[model samples]
Target: MMKITVALLFGGKSTEHEVSLQSAKNIINAIDKEKYELTLIGIDKRGQWFLCDQEDFLINGDSPKDIMLKHKGLAVAFQMGKDSEQLICFAEKTFTKSIDVVFPILHGTYGEDGTVQGLLTLANIPFVGPSPLGSGIGMDKDVAKRLLRDAGIPVAKSLTYHQWEQPGINFEAVVEQLGLPVFVKPASLGSSVGISKVKQQDELFAAIKEAFAFDHKIIIEECIEGQEIECAILGNEIPIASAVGAIIPQQEFYSYAAKYIDDQGAAIQIPADIPKEIAALVQELAIKAFQVLCCEGMARVDFFLTKEHNVLINEINTIPGFTKISMYPKLWGISGISYTDLIDRLIQLALERNIKDKSIRKSY
Candidate 1:
């Protein structure tokens, strides 16, 4: 059998661009070299698509300018079209590499929000992770919460804000309604970017303002104090849930620093210290949450086990971080699936879905 040619898409135009590059590096490293041929594609912060071969992408410093400089001259332009239009130019030379499949290591915004998925759909290429609709909903915290709530799944009570809304409108009322120590997050970001935990009225405004800088919409939810649990969902039909894992953040909450920077940021409690019944319920809810958004390929369903011992669906990550340190792959690893095997399964699912899609009637 011929090895599948996987185009690993990463470094997208989003707040999590650096994180995406890190994830891509991890995925590229973990993919079984014997079973797959990797082609690395990067989207710079300016949204320029590039075909580049690099190893271990990392932030040069905290400054975006320094990060951009390190990657400045490495990008090769790419443009797509029908048949003859599919041309890529690098250093005034044209080349073509037909992609059998795509493994997008994108985290937030343009990557996980369905923009890249939509483009791939138009290109008639199979790509891993959620479908466009699923990706869209998964990327929006507000919408995800509403859907889970409607599906009879418990989610934290949340209040949403649009970016264009005036800042002075009855924030006190919102706090009164939702209660204090609420989490304020950008509706579309991941890796805890633009997320703040506010405990007081003064801090609430600052959190909202900071969150709005990353995205127009914001979601403020009452903090759910419990074990931070996560389970991985895979497959199109009869999706299977991996062993549940609980995250123990080393800070007041799971902030961006704790998620990526610190060495001892979180401790993973595999098969989380919960009752067998609660585990089963969490697994079932994870699968249900994945399907609610019409997800395919893979997703990481997050939850909060309350002090009362109730399980609540927190959110779903369609393109959960592929970093070896990331919870998604780690959970699967403990569930008897190797990182390489997990990648292979997702690729298989993508190809299977693409073939099925081609069989669908377009003129109906």
Candidate 2:
């Protein structure tokens, strides 16, 4: 039997580029070599793609702040071939490799916010994670919360502001609406990049400024007092949710540094110490949000579980971290799926979704 050829795409122009490298490293280490032939492709900060050597793909791999993609390999471009999407490398000699599937380990902005998904869709290639529409909806917190709230899902009250509205943003008015200790975040970013916890009225201006720097739009939400709970969802039409997990962040919140940089910044509590009933509810809501957001393949549904057992939808990560300590794989690991098995499942899911999508008549 021929092994499946998997193109692992990592790094990007996003602020989470370093985090994506870490994720790609873990995925490459854990993926089953016997069942899959891996082609490593790293995207640089400028959005250029290069075919990478699996062993020597990264520079400064040990230091998170300085880690970068080693751009020595053949610069590549994705093109739609006669039968499938081809990765064309134009160097001393031109060659093409047909990719069976793409596992985009990229997080944030250009990679996660539907841009790459759209490209893959146009090429009619099978890639892991949500569809273009799903990725777009999942990346925008402001849009996601509105959809969830409309579907009768509980979410924290918030306000959305574009860069143009900066001059009119009244800190006192926002405080009056969302209350104190609001979270200011770039609307379409993840890994907690450009997110600030505004505790005082004076801090609101700086927080908004910081968030707007990363994105054209920002969201301000009332800080919900509760435990940070997360549930991982897998599959397409009828997805299943994994056992719930909790993030015990040592910082004021799960900042970018706390997530990837600091080893002891956060403690991950698997099978969160919650009642079975609450866990079940969390799983139910997780699947609901996944479906509501049009997510397929996989997603990590974050929530705020209050002392009263109320679960408030926070946000959805279409391409959640796959790092050694990342919650997505860890939650599934505790739920009877090993890391390799989880990767296999995701690949299979992507293939299945592609077949289903192809079945739909395009000309009719």
Candidate 3:
């Protein structure tokens, strides 16, 4: 059998660029070499796209841009249309390569926030993770919370504001409404970048300012004191939710450092110590959130298990981390799916979506 051509897209122009690099490295190592022909595409911090060398993918000692420039990596571009769509990789204004599948390992902002998803959709490319609609809403905490609440999923109390409203924002009113110990973060970005746990009234203004620096919109939510439970869901139409896992953070919360940088940041408890009923509830709720949000391929639904045993939906990651130590694969691993097989599963889901979507009529 001929090997499928896989384009592993990574290193996006997002706050989590470094995180994406690490994720792509892990994914590249896990993918079966015999089944797929891999093409590494790296999008640098400045938004420059390059066809990276496979050997250089895991080498974080050098910047992607510098490595790309030195290795004469191809510059990539997308041409849109039903038939005219193509991923054109140009090197020295001559070389070009055809792409079959795109595994966008990009996280946060332009990556997970629907920008790249929209681009891929228009180009008629089969890519992993959620559709543009799902990605757009899922990336924004404010919008997602509203939608979740409307869907009958319990969410924490929160307020959304734009940077322009900073001058008029009544910090005292915000504190009074959400109470102390509020979490401030950019509404759209992920990987815990520009997130702050505001415990005092004095920290409100600064936290909001810091969050707004990451995105124009910001969300301030009441910090729930509870166990952080995460459930990984895989598949397209019929998503399979893995056993619920819990996070015990050594830090104040699961920040970027805790997630990617620090080694002893968090303790993962797979098949969490929670009651069996709660575990089943988490899986059910996760599947519901995935379907309601139009998520395809896979998603990781996070929740807050309150002291009172209430399950409050935190947020859904349409494209959760795939790094060796990432919860998505780790949870599924404990649930009996190997890392390599999990990658194959997502690729299959992406192809299934492509087939189903292609069947739809473009015109009456």
Candidate 2's displacement at residue 296, Å, is 0.2
Q: Which candidate gets the maximum lDDT versus the true structure?
A: 2
Off by over 4 Å in 2: none
Sort every candidate by lDDT, greatest first.
Answer: 2, 3, 1
What is the model-wide C-alpha lDDT for candidate 2? 0.92
Instruction: List model 2 lDDT by residue over 1-364, tens digit each.
Output: 7999999999999999999999999999999999999999999999889989998988888776677788778899889533454888989989888899999999999989899999888777899999999999999999999999999999999999999999999988998999989999999999999999998978989988999999999999999998999999999999999999999999999878877888789999999999999999999999999999999999999999998888898999999998767999999999999999999999999999989988899895
lDDT of each: 0.81, 0.92, 0.85
Taking all chains together, each candidate's TM-score versus the true structure is 0.93, 0.98, 0.95
> Best-fitting candidate, measured by TM-score?
2
Error of 2 at 274 (Å): 0.9
lDDT digits (tens) for residues 1-364 of candidate 3: 8997888888777878777887887888899889989988888888888788777544543342222222347788877864432777666566456666789988998889889989998888888999999989889888899888899999999988998898988878987899889999899888789999998878888998899898999989999999999999998888899999999999999988778777578988998999999999999999999888888888899999999999999898987987655899999999999999999989988988989999999998
**Superior by TM-score: candidate 1 or candidate 2:** 2
Q: How well is each residue in 1-364 modelled by candidate 1, as lDDT tens digits?
A: 6987888888877877776766776787788999898877777778876666454344563432234313533445334544233325465555665678888887899889999899888777788988899999999999988888888988888888797774654667777878777888888888889888888778877888889889888888888888899999999977999999989988888766666666477777897998988899999999999988788899999899998889988889999977656888998999999998999999999999988998999896
Question: Lowest lDDT 10-mer window, candidate 1?
Answer: 61-70
Q: Which ranges in model 3 have alpha carbons more than 4 Å from their true place?
A: 61-72, 82-85
Error of 2 at 219 (Å): 0.5
